[model samples]
Target chain A: MNNETEIRKWLEDVMDPEIPVLSLVDLGVVGDIELKEGSVFVEIRPTFVGCPATTQMKYDIESLLHAKGFDDVHVDISYKSPWNSDMITDKGREALRKFGFAPPPKGNLIDDIDVLEHVECPQCGGTNTELQNPFGPTLCRSIHYCHDCKEAFQQFKPMN
Target chain B: MNKTALKELLFKIADDQLILGHRNSEWTGLGPILEEDIAFSSMAQDKIGHSYAMYQILEELGEGDPDQVAFFRKAEEFHNSQLVELPIGEYSFSLIRHFLYDHSDFLRFDMLRNSSYELLAQVSSKIRSELKYHTMHARTWVKKLGTATDDSISRLQNDLDALMPYALGLFEKSPYEEEIISENIFGGEEELRSRWLELIAPIISKTELVLPDPEGVEPVMGGRIGKHTEYLQPLIDEMTEVMRIDPDAEW
Candidate 1:
């Protein structure tokens, strides 16, 4: 139970409430796991400063550990490590695509916001998509239209 | 480490975000287009989130509960600039206001990244990144509409000219400005205003929109000192209506 790798493996089952297909670990928000004395402590980073799902994610983490017979569990929402799209694992990006959302282009957005206009279509894998709105239904998502697929979709926005 | 000075600064910044966020949220389901509906709503969430963080920081400093401070405060108690409290009169006016407001907001937070107040600095750094998207959104629309047609350009220009004095009020000096700067808690409003002007000029220049000459504009002041226009109190009252039903009710 004290195995950090094993604990992270278990965390892969904790899916984001908004995007049920992706796990919190793969989402790159789960920060650290530590077994101190008889308790397990975890740190989770926030993708957006005001992301409402963060609270639900915390609850899900705690519930997952408690069901595993861990009597004492502590989960802290931290800003220390900071979550970025670059941290989203390759497995996570595939999950986003499967979920019909464009994965953010892999780069620090601090250097280029213009990349929003060029997202690949999750459905058709086309680069002719147009960014309809940089803001979306959620804080971390951007609305885009894929001319190839003739459909509107969302992207997990690139952030550094 | 002047707590009074720090709280004063935090209150004003937080108030600005909360007030503007409320205004932004008013566009939910009412935007001219679906994309605009989503943009305003999303930005509203980010701004309110930023204000909530500021309130939390204030709470950690031994103030009232964040909600209490946010919902219960009178209009006079709020330190947000007069610019934010004005009604979202028209889409053009709203767009013009957003352009002017977000530039200053972005620069203020960017400068706050170097604050001697570690927590504020950390929060500022995080908030600044999110604000980049907002500023980007504003700049894109302004440039697009500002040069689109004579009709569009005229509407945006009039609004921009009308809003200039009020926008300048965003940098109204706090009484604690001396201590705030001396303690390195912030780069003062004067410095921020200069930087904001420098940053916004290029964006405005790219568009056909005409920026008002600052020297002739009499800067609207007094919002930072709790004096406000008739527009503000009604806004505070409307926002607090639900919370007033049961102020102590636990969510």
Candidate 2:
């Protein structure tokens, strides 16, 4: 298979350990995958600087590619353009919703609005929620308390 | 405090962070689970960031460039205690190491927040906020592992027995320790050490684990004076390889 095709297939099996439903490529954290000469290069942007999954993600990628006969694999971390919920592909969002996380509201496009207008609860489908903390499970997400469900859930926010 | 003393103090703080950060980064791809993978990596990054910040302060004080001060320093010049440089043996060992260090770090930063040096105090304040999460994360894992299956509890206990003595090394006094205290650069080291033990005792007790006696345990010093474990050289080589390749090149 060609490099692009090979990378796309490799990434399909690379699932997010936390959410399980989304792959790194689907999450848009996998910025670019290229074949230079005989080597494979993967570029990723971390959800946040200190996100612990980053280390594991690098290791998993290397092993997976190695298993596929790619001896030279380079992983580059880019922090120039910070990550945001908007980067989540439509397919990823769908997968997340099916996996029980209330995906970003269907009508609220990330680019159309400057700030998150209303974050719908992942549980109980309620719009009535308040931010519980700026930090959630990780720095990339914010904890929001759903008044309807009375449960705290993480909402992926745009990093500024 | 004299300039020499201030520089030593900076080295102590920076060396602790550098070594600890290196240890944490080793867990990047090997975490037991993904959620935890993210958590541990973040802590490592915060530590490295803190180290860089400390190095920057030293640079301004005419020590050297941040990278030079961090990467080129001799092993004997480093002031970090032995606690941070220890290997991250098993998962339990790693957890115990973090548990002891994170709590002590939190208290240290809190005290440093009131330092006579305004810049130092401000930096401490910023680092303290991030350290709160680090402490929470470490505490959660300690509780989870401690209360889990019997095997897990035993593993944690064994790890604690092996590493607690090293944790005491964090309080080993440097020549500048008294100078900083007298000048109010920061609070007294003995008082801080006592407070650290007091804060950690209940946490350790809650885990049903006995605090290992640290009496007469000679600290494995020289990290703060730049004598690092064999692990550090290889780590620094890889971490700075790219930067070193083109020192004059801008990214």
Candidate 3:
């Protein structure tokens, strides 16, 4: 029987498949974990509803726990409290920037999409970026161009 | 609660997303530019994902499997608005349709965020945020092309004029409208239409494109109760082709 701290620590090794630099815990979508009657019950909250990574993330969690001797594991996808960009850890934010994608701004989410313009560039740390498209190659990312670095980059866009 | 009414409401919304998702995917490689290609393709995935979510709810209410329900149904068995079932005409037409469609969708989901049906409310809250990107994408392109040049402006305006009547069909009253509204499962399509107009008015007014007087526009309705365009069956056929060939095949 492992404690919550030890279980979460073990989850740190389970990285986001798309953004390998960030872990599931760091990405802030491991909704909850409950140890009941010698079984592990995990709540996996998907960052984006359409994100296919959720399916993979669930598999990874289940396999990891199963390998850890939790035979009666229950991993339920919970949208109960939904994922917001603000959930990303401070450590995760730095990891995102280091990985060349701007971490979503903390608590700057608005319903207006134009507010997405001029996200600080992860390349040169410049605020002179322009939004190329609010959509990127993936559902959770948005495209932007940095004026200072003259580079097209992706940002893990903020969601409220 | 009127379970029948709730299911009807869910089916129409889900079917709209599914059909429009197929239409959006039609632009995958054929978009005017690489970015536009990716944009449409991304949106197509989101829309289809939404329909899948809705169908999952329907299944909980005792409907058939989501895959079979989506692939096996004839066009007339679907309740999506005719606006969504139409062919992707020219880029201008598609853009206008996208703009008109997503705005209504955004508003619809936004309203559902507070639905008395807790499951629907939870799903709607998640969906509302994603749809913001869609509306924003539509607005950016409409503004850019609507004001770009005479040709762009007139092409968009013509499409805008042509699409409005069908867009109005989006609000065709449900037979279960009273039940849905009474149960607070939804805010009703008429209310959604009015809110949609308010949401889109300033955006459209900013462009050279004129909003057709919806008052004079005879809405091309009946899709809500399963009537569809000739285009819908063909689109459904294409969508289900692979699935039909191998219903039990692994992806």
Give the best candidate by DockQ. Answer: 3
In order, candidate lDDTs are: 0.90, 0.73, 0.90
Pick the TM-score winner: 3
Relative to the real complex, the DockQ score for model 1 comes to: 0.68
Give one digit per residue, the lDDT tens place, for model 1 in B1-251: 99999999999999999999999999999998988888889989999999999999999899899888999989999999999999998889888899999999999999999999888887787788889899998988999999899999999999998999999999999899999999999999999999989999988999997789888899999999898999999999999999898887889
Clashing pairs in 3: none
Please rank every candidate by lDDT, starting with the best: 1, 3, 2
Per-residue alpha-carbon lDDT of candidate 2 for residues B99-170, written as tens digits (9 for 90 to 100): 999998889888988888777786676566557667766776788778788898898889887777667767
lDDT for position B144 in model 1: 93
**Model 1: runs farther than 4 Å from truth?**
A1-3
lDDT of 1 by residue, A75-112 (tens): 98776666778989999999999999988888765557
> For model 2, how does the per-residue alpha-carbon lDDT over A45-112 read when each residue is reduced to its tens digit?
66554466787888888889898888999987653343555678899888876765555544334333
Each prediction's DockQ against the real complex: 0.68, 0.05, 0.71
lDDT of 2 at B158: 90
Which pairs clash in model 1?
none
Q: Residue B248 CA error for candidate 2 (Å)?
A: 2.6
lDDT of 1 at A16: 92
Off by over 4 Å in 3: none
